[model samples]
Target chain A: MKKEKGKELVAGLFSLLPIILAISIFLLLLTKAFPLLSLKSLPTILFSSAWQPQKGQFGLWPFILGTIWVTITAFILAAPLSILTAIYISDYASGRLKKWLVPVIDLLAGLPSVIYGMWGILLIVPLVGKYLAPLFGTYSSGYCILTAGIVLAVMILPTIVNVSVEVLSAVPADLKEAALALGATRLEVVRFIVLKKSRPGVAAACVLGLSRAFGETLAVMMVVGNVPLTPTSLFSPAYPLPALLANNYGEMLSIPGYEAALNLAAVVLLFMVIIFSLAARLYLNKLEQRID
Target chain B: MGSRQKSTDRRLRRRHRAEAGFKLILLASIILVAIILSIILVTILWKSLPALKLSMILQTPGTGYYLGKKGGILNAIVGSLEVSLGATLIALVIALPTVIYLNTYLKRKSFLAEVIRLSLDVLWGIPSIVYGVFGFLLMLMLHLRASLLAGMITIALVELPILSRALDETIRLVPAELKEASYALGGNRWQTSTRVVLRQALPGLITSILIALGRGLGDGASVLFTAGYTDRITTSLFQPVATLPLAIFFQLNSPFPEVQERAFASAAILTLLILIISLLTRYFGRKLSRHKVR
Candidate 1:
């Protein structure tokens, strides 16, 4: 009984650590962000595009929109490709191919973001600058919204593919077998039955990917041009929220509200990411229960 | 009947055509992802081959290191090991207990367990940069300088969610019969958990730890502000440390070609280290399945 009591006390204390950490992090960011909030109304800070930290102007509209643009474009590029790859791996690929393919895809995720940034610098920037842009009768330095999106797409591909593959695998085998037995082709069975059943799971996978893309810093920073202006088009240079903090945090104390402004950015970034992730987690949980 | 039969054949041809088209697209997507992965690996290897001298791995940076004069990245390499390995150890101690308590002490499908899992998922989802900022603010609050200990603690937070989630799934797979057998012998929950649960979950436990270590080693943003960079290898917990990710980020942006080459060298070295860790986990996972009761 004594041993049990001690174990209970220790484990209980340890488990509460995460809870405490989460609460404290939120509170700390909030406290840091309070000065910005008190100085500017929420709408003025959120809707204004002015961001001269020296001038005490702290509008985050540009960065906020930049994050949205990059994340959305990345999903547009990644989602279809990832879903198709997942479908093929789950339904058609041979065992040996599946083994090889799964590991290779996962290796991309394990690669450091800096490496991806380097590749972006070496390949995508040049491709966009030299070829894709000029082909459209436009010129770009190639570090723009589209370039970041392409790189970010590659970064998030594994998350989507791995999760989608798992979700597809969870579809009851008998449903597919029954569809096959009824003279439906394999592809037809997948489209009509498996896809229909696992739609929510796939959506959850994309949501999970969105959460990752929203907060990616170094890779996007390296490629996204960091011009701090509202991106006017796909090829326009942009600055994202995480990149904002990364580039300015070192010298934030030079200005009056600079520290609070950056802290508010962190607050906003964390809030969006947490909402998306929590929703996906809860939805997946409910989906699992329903399917089971 | 002849017309109906003809239409049926037409529909069959269309279905087959659609299937073939999708098949082609799927194959193309898979090939594209594979090509991307290979391109990254090949490019890093090709660029780093010339700059990656034997001494680069063996010796610390000498005078004019950034000028491409002499010396290896011994300090950054060693510093990465200290921070990530230390973080992994710290994360493991905390995560193992939380996971055990969740699986053993809590009822299946309990609300508290669900809430904890949700919180972990959110924590994992939060970007590494936020953690960096948080770590920086935390250091400021405590009036501590950027140091190895601060970096380890920060990275430990980053690794905690990954470790706990990985462990939660693994521990849940332990056969219930083993627990019951222990209880039948009058083994307390404490004894049953430590002896049986820990043993059965050992392979997964180790794999998760290594995975967390890999993440910490590869991360640059969270440690960027917290770890702070230094040239010489210092053993003190309070001293600033260098890491491979920041090394790559800083060097690649330099105006000198030689320095950029060293960045690639660092990339190549870091890549090889992570690959080895993953390959080891795969091997151990296969070899250690013997420990499982089933």
Candidate 2:
């Protein structure tokens, strides 16, 4: 009887952990942000690009736009390549090659973000400064949206490829065989059967990748030039929401309402990511159903 | 009929060409990813060569080393281990139980479980920077200063979702029959989970913790405000700590070439640590599964 009571107690305690955590996070976010939310309209806070705390102005549009620009640019650059890589791995590669290559992709996923940032500064900055920027008739100190986008592209590529590979591989073998039996070529089978069937999963992969790129801080912070301006060109310095929060949070307490504004920004980011993740999960569930 | 035959031949040729072109593009993209990885590794190694001395590993970072001087990242290295280990332990304690409960106690298809999992996923997706902001606010509210303890707590929050999710999946995958067998033998939920389920999921649990550890070690944003950097090494949880990621971030931003070299060296150290953890995860993962009856 004592042992049974102990079991019930343990189970109840453990089950409360998740509930407590969820409540705590929600409460903390709201409490920190309450002052800001009370003072400013959400639209004013989100739409205004001027973030001068001393002047009591906290428009977050520049950072929001910056985040969108960088994420979209990264998505455009990475999606095609990742999808292609996934296609190669799932539909074309021999068994031995697939075994060798998949681990490398996993390694890419495991690499630290700071290292990616370091590489961005050492190689990507200079390369863009010297070659890529000039072609577009812009000058950069190597810290710009383009460089950040490219680095983000590299960072998110593995995620997109990994998920896409799984999705493509799940395209039933019979589908491909049936396509080939109907006189379709190997590429045709992959394009029509594998690629077509995995669209929802691929969409989920893209949304997940976007969420990652949006939330990424250290690496993007390193290369984004940390400027709070609306970017006029790809090579112009821009600051995203994560970068702003990181760059300013340390000194925020010294200024009145600064901390509150920063907290509101965090709430904004939290909500944005929550939405994207839910969408991704929704699509993934759809993909699961389709697979079944 | 002759004209139709010629058109069909042309279409066939075009389709074959398209296939070849598509294959080539796919191959190039794959190679591009491999090339980028090699480039990053080579560049860090090459740039860090000057500062990658044994003393650099042993000595604490010193002031004015940017003028071609000698100093090591020992403080940051030790600090990273201290904070990450603390965070991992806290996260593990919370996560292991939550996941166990999620898998064993909760009804698998219950709305509560679904909501919990979804909440965790959303939490996992929230960026490290947001966590830093949240931690900063918490520290302010509680009248606490940025310290090792604060850093550990913040990172624990960051890592909790990840570890719990991974652990949840691992525990969920513990063949249902094993749990059923335990129940048949008069074992309660706690006993079955603590024994049969945990033993089967040991490898995965280990891997999940390692993943969290690796991420905590690499992350700089969450600790940027919560863990004030310090040059002096101290074991006290309330004191500030320097971390490898922050070290690299601060050092690389210095204009001096020597300081930048130190940054690269710090990155190399961080990279090496992550690689070792990856290898260990693989090695232990294999070893742990070797005796499995499955």
What TM-score would chain B receive for each of the candidates shown?
0.96, 0.93
RMSD each, Å: 1.3, 2.1
Candidate 1 accuracy as TM-score = 0.98
How big is the positional error of residue B178 in model 1, measured in Å on the Cα after superposition? Answer: 1.6
Encode model 1's per-residue lDDT on A1-292: one tens digit a residue.
Answer: 8868998889978987888888888999999999888888989998899998879999999999999999999999999999999999999899999979987886787888998998898889999888999988888999999999999999999999988998999999999999989888878988999899999899999999988999999999999999889988888889999999889884557787788999999999999889998888788878766765
* Candidate with the greatest TM-score versus the true structure: 1
Best prediction by DockQ: 1
Top of the candidates by lDDT:
1
DockQ, per-model, please?
Answer: 0.78, 0.67
lDDT over C-alpha atoms for residue A48 of model 1:
95
Which residue runs of candidate 2 sit more than 4 Å off their true CA positions? A289-292, B1-11, B66-68, B287-294
> What are the lDDT scores of the predictions, listed in order?
0.90, 0.85
Give the least accurate 10-residue stretch of model 1 chain A, judged by summed lDDT: A249-258
Model 2, B71-144: lDDT tens per residue? 78899999999999999999898888778777888886788777777767767788888888878878888888
Question: Which regions in candidate 1 have their CA more than 4 angstroms from the true location?
Answer: A289-292, B288-294
User: How far does residue B130 in candidate 2 sit from its true spot (Å)?
Assistant: 0.7
